[model samples]
Target: MNDFSPALYEVLYVSTLATDQPLSVVAEIAGRARIANAQLEITGLLIFDGQRFCQQLEGPKKQVLKLIERIRNDPRHTNVEVIHHGPLAGRRFQHFSLAFSTVEDEDALARMEQLDGSAALAAFENVCEELEL
Candidate 1:
């Protein structure tokens, strides 16, 4: 079987950074992503802690992949990890935003981090399976 589905769909993922970067820096990166998304017809959400950032990008597969590539190559982030990636049945966010939340705040970081790696990969696959994407 092919690794990617034949249907046209969106890609979603979360990226994390180290605990040393400032919120302003993260905001700037989010802003740039927003502009880029606008130009590319993509939409998503971005959350930032004082030190790290998490984002969910949804758009055409190729566009989302290009955006992910740019984000991964960006020098501003340290520990950029993909939390989830697959076809989103619908867009969760209308526009790209830089959301700010504290790492110590409740289960924000834990929740996002929980969706990383194999767990998240499985979750995305399940979503595709259930939704028939």
Candidate 2:
């Protein structure tokens, strides 16, 4: 019971958003999600490089899927793409309801240059490691 099984834990996906939504709007969205996710036993990281949003949500399989559907319907998000999804042997962000990172506007634009592949994901992960968030 004390061990975490990859078969039992799930990290829904890694998604990056494209939209005209402002940073404040994104922050507000994270705030709301944080409250709700806490109740649902969800933990995740929300990384926004201003223009794009890269998030990783981990929780029970069913709840994670439902949240993904809700996110798809949210008007604030457009061109939402699930980069990767699968069960995890461990949680990348277990201490948070929704951890957030805000990238400067200039950095955001620069990140786009690297977004064509895994570089983007690596950049976000670097931020998480750097900030220990």
lDDT of 1 by residue, 88-116 (tens): 66665543432233334434544556676
Off by over 4 Å in 1: 1-12, 18-21, 95-107, 117-133
Tens-place lDDT digits, model 2, residues 110-133:
443445445555655666665545
lDDT of 2: 0.66
lDDT of 1: 0.58
Steric collisions counted per model: 0, 0
* Lowest lDDT 10-residue stretch of candidate 1: 124-133
Model 2 vs. true fold: TM: 0.73
Best by lDDT: 2
Query: Model 2, residue 1: what's the lDDT?
Result: 17
